[model samples]
Target: MTPLLTYLAKVVIVSGILYGYYYLALRNNRFHQWNRYYLLFCAILSLIVPLLRIPLQFAPEETSNSYTGQVLLLREQVFTPAAAAEAGRTDWAFVLYSLVALLCVARVAWGYWKILRLIRHSRLEFIRPYWLVLSDKIGAPFSFFRYIFWNSDSRFETPEYRKIFRHEMVHVQERHSNDKLFMEAVTALCWVNPFFHLMKAELALIHEFIADKKAVAGGDVAEYAQSILQMALQSRHDFQLTNNFSHHPIKRRILMLTASRRLRFSYLRRLLILPLAAIIFCSLAFVVQEQQVETRAAQTAPADTIKPPPPPAPPRPNAKPAKPVFDSGGNEVFTFVEIPPSFPGGEAELAKYLSTNIRYPKEAVDKNLSGTVFVSFIVSAKGKIDSVRTVGTKKGGGLEEEAIRVVKEMPDWRPGKQNGRQVAVMFNLPIRFTLAKPEKKGPDGVYTRPEKMPSYTGGEGELHQHLRSNIRYPKEALDKRVNGTVLVSFVVMPDGSLKDVKPAGDKVLGSGLEEEAVRIVNIMPAWEPGREKGEAIATRMVLPIRFSFQ
Candidate 1:
């Protein structure tokens, strides 16, 4: 589920539990005012709880697979499972939910407009601290904000009308209309949630109970119950935002009105809500992002541990090299055997094998280098890899060593055969080492070019090596597994002294990461500063130091 969908699901679950508890424990009771507030609080809590995300982190279980192949594979873009899933498909469910929610909100607004228009059409009859809108179209007495909707044609006695007026006035004075409006909005947005509508229904009944109790504070309860029944006969569902005078199952209203069945110390039941809310906070408030150690390790190679191939042999002056013979008698290795040697499996396994075995050397990556190396080796009669040697003329810095290591550990192949007997045969595999180019930075108060660019002592490789060896992941950040790159900018001074070392770029990674990056660059030794027209001058340089656990 998308984040939005996850939130909606939580809302449904939380509201469902709260409403279920209310239905089972606190409905149609003497604590009418308390129940009304409880329902509203539940609605508010359900919506708010999902938003509080407390992230919990755990170290992933470690796993390993030993491989025997040497081709390092790197893709330019690395997508996590969530990102890939989001990229490949549309969240039509969330889209539909949003559309329906918007329509529900529109309906809420439209309901309010209808009520307002009715109030406009019917002239107000002020009866001291209460405004009444008498309209035949409105079949029942309902309160919207301040105005009370009333039928212009009267069906009740004068005394009953006064009682009804008092009942509607209770809704207005206690701001019960606000509670109705709030629940109506909630029910509209979560129209699919039966509990929200049910909660709204329970709330409306509570509102009527509250008004009935107040309207009959000193008067006769039997007459008040009779008035309720008379109004219920005429009432029907109208504007959802309005507080109807007789919105209910008439029997429950009459029963609650006459019965003295209020639970003693019923407020104690309210204590249950606290613990239930705590349970919700403990369970639904957090998200566990399971990041397995194996998966994270697979996501990125530990370049620090990878050793590159040694440089190619230099030319020897006035020297002759000796070659080893195939056997006791000198013989040449055959290129074409009756049956060619094969890997344990076919090409697909061979590719997987190579990918599994090889990891790009940190040296080459640090220097932004990439190249293809052709390797030649012999598959002997015993299916053992023998006489491995690099064939390519172009030497890829540090790449050949990793490729060589991979080939040496490969599983024994199916030996080649000549005529009807096994014989020595040669095989050549071409593997490429590639690195994605880092983003190039633009000039930031620094020279883009000079007569001679500044160079760190021991060159590019050593500078990166220094950073890798000395820089430490900040303890606070490492504990939280916050991974990112901090780009550092500094000026190499005229006297080969460093100055103005600070983090560069618009993206300032906090958590002391940028501070850590800047600190390491600051501690570095002086460099050979850039010179313009035979004069040494300070030049700005950008270095991006990436800290990652995956």
Candidate 2:
């Protein structure tokens, strides 16, 4: 699954457990303050736990192909084919998710705007530590942060008015607006998650329960309950960031107020949160174990396995003497040769020639395919290219055909040298196909040189630590002895979000190794965005991760 989907799943699981615990054990208990704090803490914890990765260390396994002489060249090339008339596909799921989230944010913003306008138009009066706003437009009393809005029609001299004021005071003094604001932001981001909305409603009810308990202390509890019932019948605007006196169900508030406090020992039931948190941590830190048995079996295989017979000798008696040749498995065999092979001129000339002659296939262009293709061939003793074939271009789509055709068309190269004579030698060449284009500019604008370069939360060392802890080596790669470095490139947006993650070069080690590298990169937390001239800007970055069994 993608990282976003995985995070959403974790949120659902954690929220479900917390909500279930609240409903069964703590709903009717008299620990209203404890319940209020628990909901806020759990909500924040659910978002954080998914990002905590725990590293697991194991002894390195031995492998046969541990030679380090073979050089691996990493080449990155971008291709943008001439714009074709292909129909564009719409990402409906992303569109729907973004639209819903925007609507939720707008709804929250509108509520805040209404509250601010009410404060602006109403008469402000000082009531002890609280600033009271007398608004004739407001139908019910509510408290937001340090400001309390009172219905202008209510008589301040009455006993009922005094009781309502006490309830609003509890909300302000305890900072209930902080909890509401946090939950409101959560709801806006995850509007599609019905659980968040349900949690929000439950938290509002908890706030009311806490305020009701404080309001009735050392006073007539029965009379206070009657005032709550009367206020519930009045019209009220349900602002998300405010604590409204009569917003919660009237019966639940009155019942909670009158219920006997649970035994102090029963409060230990809250300890259930500890075990629930542990389960969540373990689930998020899941790791895949390497297949030791298969690795052992491979290590024990016989070295003297059946091998192919030697190639037949040349028919001409006067032909040049044969020289040693290495098979694909690196095993030595005799072949007609003399000198080792070399490209005409030198390595520099070979690169220049390939770049000058290679053509991007029209078929590949139409499909927007771009990558490197590795071509392997034999440089004959006569300095002629023959037996030309492609080693890997697993991204087929006519790319392999184009690479092979270019190799066959090359002029004769310098003959190989073996035992002071010309000989045939194997040669591997990688040709890249790219459509020339300019660097991409992000929505907020791209930065070529930034005052502060983007980095992981801690530093580059922490990024490596994160990758080492989270990357899961593919089992197929281990069994086949496929190991190499995979280069991944991504764009860090101005808002510190990652986008356009992809492999920077052709896949060197197949068997899902490259895919695993890309997955790990995608799951990384956003970096500190780069800044240019004191403003955040998008910057592209490339990272290489190596996979090895030994």
Candidate 3:
């Protein structure tokens, strides 16, 4: 069952249980009957609610795949292709309804079985005064025990036995047992319902009331009361189905039987049940319908799928001179451009290679051009790089130039593929630059740049190409059209070359692509470590990249 339907069922069950208890406690005759009717209504409604919700008609999935679309299309085309889907969904609802119905039937059957069990264990006997067969069962008072066999239990006083026999006969003649059997099945079906219990108890009380009145009509009330007392005082047998002359509130039953007052019936009281049931159903429907509307609204709300902002790029080492894109502030601007990628191994392998090779740049520290730069790059289907572009830049030492150099030198990256065909994808990178403090130690316990140099693993062509293809621009960043390089610097480990970088050159694209560029530069196939005495050494070089919208 759907969660919504399950919730509604729980509500029905709980409300029914509570209402059942309230009427039971009050014990008004009219209220008792009304409560039973109300319970019946709840059961019927619970079964029907899910059925009503089955979307018999719906909008075509081709036009739109949302709930609203389905609804609208249903109203329009009447017989859209989406009708099949709607039918399939409604079929499930029917299945659920069938299951709940089966459960209700099973529950009713169980109740009948229990009643039979109670009857089987009750004591059945024929006793005196009125010479009637009586079965004393403990569940609902005055109920006939179908499984009981009439017999005489020789343990009763003359008048006491007589009154008990008369009462039992009244029950038998009234066929109260059959009435209780029907009620039992209904109660069992709604067993989780507390109201069923109340109704059962009320029905039992009414059976006794009617019997008591009959017994006194042609007999003595005083004599009957005395006989009831005597039977209580005598040896009482606990039989599953033995009808005892006296059971529960004997004094009250005697008084009510003798009293000359007739129960007053008010038109208003009798009329209350129908309206109350209607109100309850209407309220439930309104609540559930309102919730459904809200759920449908949320599912149809528009979501923005525009690309994210470009990320910053990492600092590059000794970047070659290039046409500088700048702002009014004399600062360089690096515009993110798309590039193709080369995938020698695959996307997975490329990701691993990038993880292993990318590193921070050290020259950025010497130049003190440490900031975040956003770079954009593309990946081609054949694992090759077309171009790497930087968007933002940090000022000084051509920080943008440094970022571009690192990205341009990136190793070839594995291309991303969709359905066996190679597709150009854009990716973004952000590089951060931080100056090494004098207190910081380098390899060999000394500031040797070679031993701590950053290395690349795969072909530089592949990594560069992938970045260019996947890069995207941030709407806000593009809208501002801000152009200015924010040069960034970071150390490349092992080779101590420029790797990570952030550029403050331009805000035309968001910062994500710029950051992506930095990461790719850091992941390029390892460069031959700058050497000092043929030993691997780390060196720092600073280069700046440019950014400009095409």
Candidate 4:
């Protein structure tokens, strides 16, 4: 999976586990406040646990293919959307994700707009530590940040009114609106995640339960239940980003309010499962390391069964390496080791990277100079390149400079290692600079279209068959599992001779892929020329040559 997809998958997994455990352990608990925080905690864990990483150190590989005289290519390539589209890339999944996310955002914005407009039209009734918006537009009571939206015509007695006022006041004081907003943001971001939506619904219901419990404190619970039923029978309304009195199921609210004996320390059950869940989650998040004793035994003995472990050897005066063991950056390095540094995809990818990225200097091409320049650098223990320089018999005409420039553009490589430990190693690369022979254009003018279009000797199928038969995947790219289609454009002259063959787009897929495509096109049999006014004419044509291993 792509990195983004992987991250989302992790989030989904974490949320599923936590949510499943909660439903089984604490879902029906009467401890509304504890349940509320725990649910929020689960949301936080689901969102953030995937981002945490625990680095585990281990012995390095016994055979690293790092600096085996290879250039490495980074998987990263920057392309503008125009360039990507030109290369025939269209990510429909990304489009869908963006569209859904935009809708969620618009929904949230609309909710805020409705709240603001209601507050603008309604008259404010000042209540100590909070305020109320009395509006006939609202059919039910709901609490926002510090403002409560109440029906101008309420059908409750003085005692019931006080109890209901306390309910909204509880939401305002405890800042449950912020929790709803946070829940909104999560659901919006992970709209496809059923657990997030479930969590949003669960959180809102929990908020109601919390308000009910606080509102009925030292008051008649039966009367409050009666008042809820009275409000239910009246015309109702609902809105988002607000604590609506009638938004949740009426029966569940009354039962939770009347239920006695809070689930005492239900968190204990959750805590018991946490360590086990954490252990499993951590195993996936953390890196596995090499065994310490096994590494030592592997370096010394042929068989682990026969050896008891050797004692430390005596220190020598020349214990330090004769050559510099550390680079200017203060990291330990090596001239040679069990494993040499390499590119991410190894030698083949290295070759592809160099061929694709290294461009011959304009000055050198103009002066018709070609040579091989030797470039050297350090591949650090962590696969970083440093200390880049060039050395060779051939130097001038900007050849050495260009070689150095491209080498410096390189990212980190697979670092060299010795005795199962990572160490930096020296890297050397030889880059060849050569210019292609410029093709001479025919005297006949190229035409976009004529009275008659050009035709292959046989048909389009035969032309494709010829390309498939003759074109070979570039060896360097093939070794590294590289594949792409090259769009080659050329002209069929009046006499049916092909000329000016080249890739047709701004995208340059190097590593000999384009060269192979061009080679196949140039060697094709001549086509029957286009015509205009009973006379043969040259016509431009574009052909797509695909190189797919599968």
Put down candidate 3 lDDT per residue, 32-112, tens digits, no spaces: 344444444544554444333211222111211110100100000011113223333455754665676578677666655
Identify the superior model by lDDT, candidate 2 or candidate 3: 2
lDDT (Cα, tens digit) per residue for candidate 1, span 163-256: 8888888889989878878888888787777888888888888888888889888998898888778877867877777778777788898888
lDDT of each: 0.66, 0.66, 0.43, 0.67
In model 4, the number of clashes is: 8
Per-residue C-alpha lDDT of model 4 across residues 1-550, encoded as one tens digit per residue: 4445777888888888878877887786787787788779878888887776544544433432221111221111222223323334455776788789889989998998989998999999887768889987887688999999887887556888878878888899999999999999888888877898888898899998889889998888889998788877875664789998765578888898777775676658757666856775685667542221110000111000100012222334544322344666898666545445656444445555665566656677568776556576788888888888876476587877877787788767656667877888765555545454222223455665455667777753356346545655565654444444465778788898989898876566677878976887799898888777888877776654444332
Per-residue lDDT of 68 in model 2? 13
In model 1, where do residues sit more than 4 Å from their true spots? 55-90, 127-129, 155-157, 261-265, 286-295, 301-550
Can you list the residue pairs that collide in candidate 4?
A: 60-420, 66-340, 66-341, 66-342, 67-340, 67-341, 71-350, 383-412
- What is residue 242's positional error in candidate 3, in angstroms? 7.6
Hey, what RMSD does candidate 2 come out at? 21.4
Question: Which of candidates 1 and 3 is the stronger one according to lDDT?
Answer: 1
* Highest TM-score scorer: 4
Residue 18 in candidate 1 has what lDDT? 94
Quality of model 4 by C-alpha lDDT: 0.67
The regions of model 3 sitting more than 4 angstroms off are 1-151, 154-163, 182-195, 233-244, 285-550
Per-residue lDDT over 418-478 for candidate 2, one digit per residue giving the tens place of the 0 to 100 score: 4555655555455555554533353456553355667677653356356545666565654
Q: What would the TM-score be for candidate 2 when compared with the true structure?
A: 0.53
